[model samples]
Target: MSDPKLLLIDAHALIHRSYHAIERDLTSPSGEPTKAVYGFASTLLKVIKEQQPQYVIATFDAGKSFRAEQFAAYKANRPATPDDLKSQFARCQEFCRVLDIPVFALAGYEADDLIGTLSKQAEEKNLDTLILTGDRDTLQLVDAKTQVLMIMGSTGELKLYDDAAVRERFGFAPEQLIDFKALRGDASDNIPGIAGVGDKTATKLLQEFGSVEKIYHNLASVEGKVGEKIQAARAQVELNKQLVTIDRAAPVTLDVNAARFGEYERAPAVELLRELGFQSLLARLPGDGDGDAADLAAHAPQDIESKYAAVLSETDLAALVKRIKKNKAFV
Candidate 1:
């Protein structure tokens, strides 16, 4: 009776989060690192169990983005990806493949762009979309037809942001976040906005002026040192706007029907889990009766711990603990 829900996953965000959150040095039987793989699988399964989305799509960052080309210092502040974690990305893709979830990655674009494009496509098809990511950059995509399911770091807590939630948090519309970031800049991504503007100033400016373009048009009305800073960084703010705004027109196509959930081969999934030393997750896979999304939704929501307890025996829990304890180095 309700509109179908499509879950859009930001693979790089989750993978990065997982790599940091899982402090252990998890490895496969043959000694390959798998902490990122384990954490990603755990989080992914937890989302699927709780949301029961009718369709699912995952997006990954292919390589250097156009933003990096436009601005040489784009995300230059971040450290290089660890060799162990870098190796696990392919494993994450393999995990998605075994589950039959379609993944999109464009060399010239980040995963955010792919998600923006797909969410817009899903909206046009009359499907409701839920974007799952740890990155707040995707918050700008929240609208009536699309919501952002943001995963808090290490804690693994999820906060869903709809139109009202976005407005309530930022004191402005979701789209205004771009303008906010344009004024305040993002240290994580190394985007330098205005010279002396901070969060309070940016928020106040956006609350009154609406957008970067509007603020520039009404520069005379904006007085004081803050106004001077805005005037000084006019060109940088325009470039920041370009950097912060998600690309909704990314060159990626979405076939909604192909993304249908609960259609993967159960046998390969089980084997893959075994190979990766994820014995506990084996019980979480869908059984024959779970072929339909309606059937999955009919069941009441259960947290990851409850699901594991209901399906796994004490021996399984002990083995899981032992496997975790065996790892020493931090990821």
Candidate 2:
């Protein structure tokens, strides 16, 4: 590929959004939960054709990680994936297999961190990286070299976000979104932020002080109960920042240039789509006149540098280690 353009799709975010957006309980021709499959397929095609990315890869949660041990309440509020949707992730992977897109996952980090690591590397290679995520937290990755294509609608509209857009939306710079999140806490991830802060208040405060550290360093500069409240919860805000910040430097054993996109053809992809009862999505995929062709067409894995070595190396790992105090950490 001569031009450098990469598209990073948030696999779990796509599936979760798909599961809820196309809320109809859909079963395949063989009776499988196909809503997510359909949504993922449709999204894949749109990204491939519209973004015309030179390289592409999707990241998923490996399910085993130390994030839980560092803190038990991380993501504690997201209700369990319904039995129905939980049943479909494997079939979704099968869909990825049939498409030939290089699917990746890692231990000790969520998909966002993987995407962040990949985006950082791509930027270094002079490649423009676009992150396709439904989660707002990934906005932290938005910069000149990276674009966050957040799925904004049920049918197929994407909110393309760059640094400017991130700045405009939250009144805080894109890099500062993590800080805003750190202060207010994220209920979705089960983070209990300062008691009274919400989005509006969080944005307002960050606009003034800039970051969690600054807000603390200059707490006396603020006014009203909010200032008193902030000082009171200073300890919690620091912890939230740690939780909300995606470790962009997380050690990765893979490469972005070596990522393959060969499976998105028109034939077998269509066959799999047909098998999954994803007719609406099938209608939207890259068609080969006769269909059943995997629309994706690139392939291979690349070697990635140790992006997280400085912060998460073996020698530094023990600093965050703690015994898993509960059984649900694994569940």
Candidate 3:
């Protein structure tokens, strides 16, 4: 049987989660921020050790990619990342680079879109997939073969949600996320919920009606001003649903399987992590090591037919630097 190919990790989500987790104490040698970096590298190492898939891709949001054009209110409440937090992003990339991980992002879409596109692609190719993102909005993409690995606070616990799991958590299927969000609205994204309805009404209404459009099409039976509200604001609700819904049909240009795990050199990745002060991460690199990653994940790069060490590429390093400079815009 072919190895399962998993795509997508919310790098920033993990980074930020990591930062806050060890917020009070973590610091670098030169008196800089290391909480996020340390946490990020540790989670990455653990993830690698746990889900040693044949393919992997770590994604992050590009600067101002979709906030202005899409909703003009997207992620509006997030304060500017402090200089400390900003510094860690580079270290995060450095960590990925040392591990030979491929990270992708485009100018017009958020990481959510990238995750959506890539997840859909993996499903189309019949690959069992795991999506690691702190954002609950991504739960909409969960399916039988595609499960969302959502973080459970800072306890290092994760809830694996497939079709049944998603139903259990959200009280409905993945398709209901759009309508659910539309009714409750996303305060985090500055979206206004239906004036009176909250989670209770949203869940109940969507459970009965299935989708926002369907609910509106049969709005007359709803109680009080609720029916009138749906009739009056039909356009906004539909648009909100459109905004919240994951775009599974997006033309994903990345060949997810191309970022195969077996291609990476474990030793160098370990060495790199060590250099970045990723203390325990090296022990987690997939290889001849005796671990769960050894069984489910193929350790060595299949592309390397002969038992010879591969040549490292300087051009790859230079290209990565260029991308960091371009997207990060930090000196």
Candidate 4:
């Protein structure tokens, strides 16, 4: 059997993607914004059905991260979260809670850092880690035991990036991605790397020198304008490295067993979905309402690979309902 996979979700990235992917604004019965909530729920359910992971956890950015505190310009280029999307953040978190998934949100750490910490822990425990995120910074965490399911486009297509994929895309191992980003800088996060360096220059430099420190040691060998840029921006390059490197030892304690994807109670998840006006999703939950027959028919696993349906009729729904009878078990 394959090793138990621990799925770590970047809450804000997925929420932002969901909010924008959904063209029309959706609202709850009370008229509160529900677009992000619907998108997150739908995506989570879809992944759950497909991956069938034995564990799931979500990391959210609680407030200004340590990077922002250290560097005033960190993420400065990014706009403020939209009021509508902000309104749905709470509901999105509540949905995770209702699903019995463990959530980690450190006050001064970004979700990437928390995920880094957890992924490192998963490695120690010999568990496989899969990160679902749209952020490229996460690519730094991709290793043999840890892989990232990165969103490739606006259509929600995902590319599972492993060691080879990371090397192929970034032209270096996962360990050197921080150095590559440090050299090129990330305009999206407002991180200013070495002045004149860009992706091609960064990749070529890392390929030759292996790291920022090594590249500096061999600066004399590099000939051209790129050499001058690196010489002049030494301090900025170091600072950018500090800003881009993910802290794998963030001060957050996580119990691995607590994050195991156990059986979830259907009532609370169903109730939250109803509150968020996610009528279509209700069918995905076991014993959601009086629509057992309809739910059984609606979620009948047309893809066949889902294997969520063992039988064709109400028997399948009942069997699933029976399986999740335990408080912390999964159906």
Clashes of each: 0, 23, 1, 5
lDDT of each: 0.88, 0.77, 0.74, 0.84
Error of 4 at 291 (Å): 7.1
Model 1 per-residue lDDT tens digits across residues 1-331: 1589999999999999999998779999889999999988998888999889999999999989999987899999999999989999999999998999998889999999999999999989899999999999999999899999999869889999999999999899999999999888899999986777878888988889899999999999999997888888889899999999999999888897789988888878877887888877876875553433333344437664532333278888787677668975323
Measured with C-alpha atoms, the lDDT of residue 22 in candidate 1 is 83
**Candidate 1, which segments miss by more than 4 Å at Cα?**
289-331
Identify the superior model by TM-score, candidate 1 or candidate 2.
Answer: 1
Q: Candidate 2, which segments miss by more than 4 Å at Cα?
A: 1-3, 153-156, 253-257, 262-267, 279-331
> What is candidate 3's lDDT per residue for 1-331, written digit by digit as tens?
2447675788878887887777475665556668788887777777777777777888887787443566777667778887788988887887776566788766666778888888777777778778887788888877776778887787757787888887887799887897899887888777777787778888888889898878877887797987877677777687688778765554456675467775666656655554555545545666654543443245345665555333369887777678778899633
Query: Superposing every Cα of model 4 onto the true structure, what RMSD results?
Result: 12.0
- Tell me the lDDT of candidate 1: 0.88
Highest-lDDT candidate: 1
Mind sharing the TM-score for model 3? Answer: 0.81
As a whole number from 0 to 100, the lDDT of residue 20 in candidate 3 is 73
- lDDT (Cα, tens digit) per residue for candidate 4, span 47-100: 777777888999999889888878998888888788888878888889988888
Q: Give the Cα RMSD of candidate 2.
A: 19.9
Q: RMSD to the native, candidate 1?
A: 9.0
